[model samples]
Target: MGENLSRRSFLKGAAAGTMSVAALGALAACSPSGAASEAAAPAAAAAGEGLAETGSYDVMSQMSLLNRNMTEGAVAAATPEEFIVQKGDGALQFAPGGDPLGITPADFMQNVPAWLGEAPEITDIAGTESCDILVIGAGNAGSVAALRAQEMGKSVILAESQTYDEYDEYACDMACYNSKIFLDKGTPEVDPIDVMNEYVRKALGHVNLQIVRDYAFRSGEMLDWMMADHIPAEYTEKYAKTSNYKGNENFSGQCAGQWSWPAMTQWRDEETNINMWPFVIRSLHTSLENLGGKVAWGYQALRLIQGDDGAVTGAIFQDIDGNYQQIDAKAVIVCAGGYGGNPDMRLDLSDSMRNLAWAYGADRTDPEMIGGMGRDGSGIRMIMWAGGTMEAGPRAGMSIGKNGAPGFAFGGAWPCFGPEGKRIYNESMYKFGSNGHLDLMPDDSLLVNVTDANWETYLSYQGYGHETMDRSSDYMVEEVRQNMADYQTGPDGFPVRSFARFGKEYSNVWAADTLEELADIVGYTGEAKENFLAEVAHYNELCEAGRDTDWGCDPQCLFPIKDAPFFASFGATGGQPSNGLVMLSGVNTDGQYRCTDGAKAAIPGLYAAGNTCGNRYGIQYGTPTAGNSCGFALTTGYCAAEAAVNDLA
Candidate 1:
């Protein structure tokens, strides 16, 4: 067998799991629900009239769509599957062991070059501090490390760019099946071995099996500890039966394994119904403080300080007062989020998708920077300056929508009409696996979502863009909850329920009474426009036929554009798609969270956790699951702290 094929031998019995890039892209927007329709055609398709039928599906009832599409409809096939090129030869390389999928071990673990040419230099320091371990970014991953170090009685210091006292370090989503919640129930039916098996398959064997094993065995214990020691009891019950990926339960024999904090729940009023995450995080923060943990709220790690021999001793940090602070440490954990919020840094992953969720023109409902925090690119870049390699991933959890508040309704059947005026992907697969963003490239990303006026009026724009705003009187917020309730009530309910924030105020929406006019408004020109009209006509014919002969789209989403005043909405992607808006490319790490500086060696005393580190994904984001971003944060944070503590012991 080949070297890579040989490595798979050891992964056979391993039980491990964490993070799905796609799950993160869909869940990060603070919205929820999923569905895939495979049924009798909608009334509109059968009647050949726009007067009847609302095109959408019931996630609970129509699970076949989820099972069939989520499993089959990837951007490209894996293993022995034949490669079907989506674009020209210049399109993304989709070979099973290629850049957009998997790379050779040598290439993936290469050393970072000293000649990046643009990295900042570190020299003098205003003041120096020492610790047994120093951890950066007090978000999900960092918090775990700091607390775990305390458990081991190691002197630790944790730093954050934004002070939690002023701005909450929001963390709620946690996916692990080993906790008391699962173990206590005999028939919990979640197999860690099975989870790990699924995990490696999803990661395309590009991950370190050791890391998966470490997290797999420790997650339940860690979560149990958090529940018993850090968080209150009542909040634990609030966790719904969901996995990191929203629709994971639809998969056969896949236990409902995902959990969330209250505040992070979608469309709910943050002020009225408080999220338990803030409390859990704060409690951990307090535990760190009580253990005499040193936390620098406004201290930002600027560069990783390395010895001439390549041992990382510390980092150069920018203090709140604008002075440089030096941290002398035996070990360090970098946990700042990935470059999701940094548009410029995002070019590494998406040249066209340069903006993040909060960046102007991005069509997301949540106010977070692309992945989490601002896409500052600091943590990943700092390690790059120390010669750390980055994992090139096509999946950044970027499941974006054109209009209709893309976050809440990741499932509906709205046609994504490309420049060719053709259906680029199954509407459900828009963000699932279709790297349509890259294949479409410059102009194809500018595709539009054709919807009716009713979708825009009721389903879009649910609450304030920022969390600080009062949601008490926000009718949109209330309306969304009711809509969601109605949908969950079964056949008598609305076809869809959402808390989206799609409206004229978002600015990407356009309405035209005629298809020709609609095409003109969105910049469909020349043959593209001709293609657009032909597409609409052919699509109308298919609607009448009640089947998508061209793309296998669900009839539920096949409601014709025949309705006058038809609506189309666009966003910061300019209607383009992406692996995810978050800048997913970043520093490579061993499964142990040790930052690797090429094949020469893993830089000792230097580790990366959370989005700052890569390798949890081979190329695409977590496919079968979604919140791998957050899951990685928790898993690596706990594991990194354990490694550092063991060394000191």
Candidate 2:
């Protein structure tokens, strides 16, 4: 297959009226999920309907409809063996080792995407730079890699697409195991094996245990080294003191009963107002520059250069001014983030991730700008061109539930009703867990969140991320009320992106003194209206009895809707069925942070870290703590540098 064989290219062709239904089906044979659905007549029929009627290729709509059609009368498939593409089991599942399934990377991805075409065959380069190590991307991982290599006395060059002033930096908490900071604070040390096993369990054994082991055991030392002279333990102490923590028990096992620990460390300097990760980025840059290392800002990697023996020797980079340059290095570390910025790459991985979450910082449109943040898939593609494989779908994403009424954290705790007014989730699950169910709902139907006047009381039940009940301040409650008031006072017929044209006039937030009026305001009629009222009444009953018999919500989260002036927030308030902050998977790698070939052998001089590398979190982006990704990035960058240093020596 040449350049036109990619699924994304085919969809564009179909949308442009160059392909027919038969041609689409022929292309579907290449897709793992599409191939499985082809054997099921209902799914096939729905696929045909979706393709034939729609002017453009909306794969998620087609796929969602196809799954709904297949599950209409069929029982939920209990195992992968029973149904290759399991449906209607809350979340979608696929056969293991198959496309959209867990374990190994998809077989089809062994072939690179045709869209990349071929790298520029430029002979006359504007510049040719030589370095001992070349680290692409100056984000969290690349920055560390460059600094570590330079610190190891290697001539390092850090190539970043963005300028020095515009380097993408964000503050974040990082996960580490048994750091001195934690030890001094009396935090418990965790077993690295237990952490890896838990990750494997969640990923259904789709993880690289060795790579995770590197992160699990070595991340603390990496953190300690990075934090040296930058972040102070006193800063962490101040943060701990200000936290409104009810207890560690309340936050335990928040990700579907996954074990959680106090291993997550954040640098909060409320006193000096310095952000941790940003400061770390600046510090790394300063140290690298001070060590006589160079940072080639505004240079993007175009392709990898491999030797005759198939070892990656160097790479080609394109500057913003349409100029080309070659950088030859003993080892090239690719930590240029993940592919979340590219919609086609995300769609290629999992249609769910592509259609479900909006990518963060995805507004870059320059031809030279591959992706914003580390989300440009260029680094992964360059490695793939040099024969690196990627982790297969259904890939995990980091959906740190931002959906809710503005300024409120109780979106996941309220009673949620689907389009037919049926209760969808337990609403007590973590935001991502509950929102995942909402995303897999049968159709792109309207979903609403209903809560009583005692919305503030629900704050007590809210755990993790935005917990405020332990604090004496009523400011959060007031803020939520004010935000709701502002939403209600907005003009009618506000456009909600998720809603179709028919519901454009429906203001997303609605309020009324009575349940009936609230239902009317939300456009519920006939059976839907009755179902809404019934669900609310049943929920109130459950709340009064201090138990949720229907959805089995936590008893503590069961607040009654008996109070007057009940509120209903329309659309998906728990979590939008869109791209999360970022897609967490990437090109597959070995324990040493080397991007490996299909045989799982390290490609001699290529390494990857951060989101550019994969097999860390497994099938889903679930982690033992909030900052695992950040910690893994820092650790892998440091480790990749060490590996390169040793190999070069």
Candidate 3:
């Protein structure tokens, strides 16, 4: 999913004298090709001429001349059009314009660099050590697990694929699109439970009930814990406000009805402990060391080691030096995130989910673009290999922009694209309709609509304290509205103002004059586009009259789409695709977090937490919710540690 930057970071720490170009050269020279001459002088001579370079090539040539000729003959038997473009920069440029035809020139060229038909083997393990409890992944869950276990007086080792400093900032200051009410001004009151429930119902069809309940019930407490630990409480408040309240008069009902309950709005404030995701990891890591718990950064867990009885006994990992080592543990907690980082695992999860991998491209660059490491689904796969059942497809704890548009920024009230982009949807509409729409539509389907009036209304509304909408709110609104209106009217209207911004692309905005045309331009067609436009037209008519019969869209709020040359752009449902944030299905465990296989479960030493355990909620995201993944990780890790200590006693 991402490149390993630990070595780079470590290399940065080396004294200037220790790290020389000579060292790099020496490493390169150690390669097989660099040492080829040592094997055989004749082979080295042949390699220089690109002839039968090695005995291996001679063997291949002798065995495959006839077969190669036959293959060539078969290929030549076809017309010139059948000839695949040979490998070269030129061939790649002209590689059969669209989608490629039967082994395209591009494919042929691509295959040239792929000398081996198989993937290269990975045989490196970074810094590894033993501990009584080993926590993999250093995100929200892993940090909590390590803290909880250490608090229980257990010797723990927390291993992260990346450094603690880098992991700490992963979420902090990394701009993302999140709908949460800011505590700055007139933010509406929202119930955490109702908001989350609606979120779950909308996102997952109320199928995974327990996960929703657990998250909702514990989220407030988690916020409190985070605040106490120095993360800003305003972050929670902001998230709740923009995401849950959506700025309606009956905010509580809107939240409760939606099954989302209030989480503290103060989470966004760095001063408040609510922004504790990063601070907590940093603090806990420091605190764990103070408590005599070991913390190893830049160590990647390669696999879980199990005894003959199949009980997890330890973990194998790679250190910064690329050395494999095994560490024994009384208990192993897999807190690595889901497959959002692993494209192949994502593809294998489900065809429907494959399209979702591109969703995060909006907020952050593609995983490939960022060279982000640590998304291999190794944690999920390791558990699966050990007979642990996976929940349904991955759930979203992140957001992606519409289509594959890049440079989409998160935050602010409503669906604000990066700086200077127009507001896409009425924030209230997100609270009222998105959950239901998400429930009914496919993952790739667009749920929100934007008309001239709605765009104007959104601009005006955001300034009225729609949570995260702040100082730049008016500017952002005006900029986006003008761009959209200009795109609708062309030169007949005023010249479109350009908002010079970094990483911003006009292509990010998909606009068309009509719903059908918009859909066609955006690659949605036929019944999908027709039905969507019909829905928009129907909604617009309702807005004109001020009543929505279908979804009870507020009449006072209805913005007409009657403006000539209507425009529609791709927008998200203000939520990431489901990416397994909380798993509702897993090994049945008691209140104590003990694993039970239903009939005399023998793995007494085994325990599960977070997404690894079974149902704790009925259905919902924050509605009537309890805890988040962090809370559960802490609680269960603590519970497991306590049980282990007592058993030993």
lDDT of each: 0.56, 0.65, 0.44
Candidate 1, residues 509-616, lDDT tens digits: the string is 355667787788777789888988898888879878978788776554456667665656432233433434344456777766788877837888888887776766
lDDT of 2 by residue, 1-649 (tens): 3564766556556667888887766755655455334543322222223332544333443233234455558686687877755433333243312122111223234244554556656677898989999999998789889999998899999999987777766536577776666666565577877776766776788777877778878888887787674345454445422222222433433433445555665544434324445654676787788899999998988898999999888888888787888999999999888877775665566444543444423322222222212376899889888888887666756652224322123233477788888777776654333245544444447677777667656655455332223222123324445655444422242212221111112234555778988888777899999998998888788889987778888776677888866777676443333345577788888777888889899899999988898877665566455567788888889888998899889
Off by over 4 Å in 2: 1-112, 170-194, 218-220, 230-256, 261-280, 320-322, 347-374, 396-412, 431-436, 440-444, 452-530, 540-547, 554-568, 572-578
Q: Any idea how many clashes model 3 has?
A: 102
Q: Which digits, one per residue and each the tens of the lDDT, describe model 3 over residues 513-619?
A: 55555556544556655655565566667666765565554344455655546444344333443433332333344444444443435344555555444443323
Give me the overall lDDT of model 1: 0.56
Better of 1 and 3 by lDDT: 1
Worst lDDT 10-window in candidate 1: 461-470
Best by lDDT: 2
Point to the candidate with the largest TM-score: 2
Ranking by lDDT: 2, 1, 3
